[model samples]
Target chain A: MSIEVNNIHRIKPIASYIVVKVLEETKTTSRGILLPNSKESPQKGEIISVGPGKKSESGQLKEIDLKQGQVVVFGEYAGTLIAQDESSKYLLIKEEDVYGTYE
Target chain B: MSIEVNNIHRIKPIASYIVVKVLEETKTTSRGILLPNSKESPQKGEIISVGPGKKSESGQLKEIDLKQGQVVVFGEYAGTLIAQDESSKYLLIKEEDVYGTYE
Candidate 1:
């Protein structure tokens, strides 16, 4: 299942945590029939929400480098699985767990 | 083997990393023989060195709360094993891996 990048989310993460919606891949047959791959979840996703930042030892807030709506790739087993609804699954992960951004 | 807290270390860590010397327990037999327990390595250790701190996304350097000569406890499989010399083994780990400090 996937969510629109512009959709509003009710959950807010704290301290460098990010809310991500996992992107699912859709395959197509020669006849243009769509086949949903349910065996595995992709590591790529869109950032739905971002935290303010992690506090330094000196009590300074360091802002995260990422912004909402950006697509990013994370580690295979990086985040905790969370469900926003019965059909929508989100991932809560640290900004450091993001491997890179997709252009 | 354990190292003296006052001894100076030649290696320095970078980016919120910490260098720790694992403490070894020594037992005595009824006949007054000193026996070194070599079966398992303790998770407790003395902080030999610490990094400045992890850089914030804004490029600010935070200070670590720990200092040299302080005893700290880490996870059972938290750090990477490194050797300063033939008899001295040290663990290189992130500051976050430290569970607590011994007062």
Candidate 2:
């Protein structure tokens, strides 16, 4: 199945790649001070769609351990920016790039 | 079996990784002028040992396509430098990092 983000782009990840909806953090600090965007922090995103896993050397399609809607963390530089619109941005990353899932 | 380089380091690759013996290019030009080492060129190496292949999602070990003594090419920056001695240097690289084999 394909994931429709912002009801605009229908994306279907392939081969162990996953589509993530970047979860933007609150731009303001606890003291109500606006903070500039930082690239050093680990990126947090919600898995929109997971691919059918990568193929093994024997040509078998292995299943990925992740699922859609899981909030996952990844490196700041990981994944490729796929789509960016007014409201949200999307990234396409390999399953291995995902560090782990969080609450 | 482990591969020995310079009769000093015995390396055995693990899980889709391969030990490569870097083949140093000729330092002299056509006119016998010594050229400085360049990192822009693709590195050439001979496969010293191949890993048993990465395990699939089912935990089955797939077989690597390469074999020992085969000359392969890879990106200049690919792989990790595992060992270096007086006569030869060694690198540990994944099978996927190998571009292809040549005579």
> In DockQ, how does model 1 score against the reference complex?
0.03
**What tens digits encode model 2's per-residue C-alpha lDDT throughout B9-42?**
3444545777788998775767998766664556
TM-score of chain B of each: 0.70, 0.75
Tens-digit per-residue lDDT, A1-103, candidate 2 = 2234565237788898998888875434334443333213346688989998888777877777678988775556789887776788899988766544544
B8-43: candidate 1 lDDT, tens digit per residue: 264456557777888754446578786565644337
Identify the runs in model 1 with alpha carbons over 4 angstroms from their true place: A1-8, A26-42, A84-87, B1-58, B61-103
A75: Cα error in model 1, Å: 0.8
Question: What DockQ results do all the predictions give, each relative to the true complex?
Answer: 0.03, 0.03
Index of the highest-lDDT prediction = 2
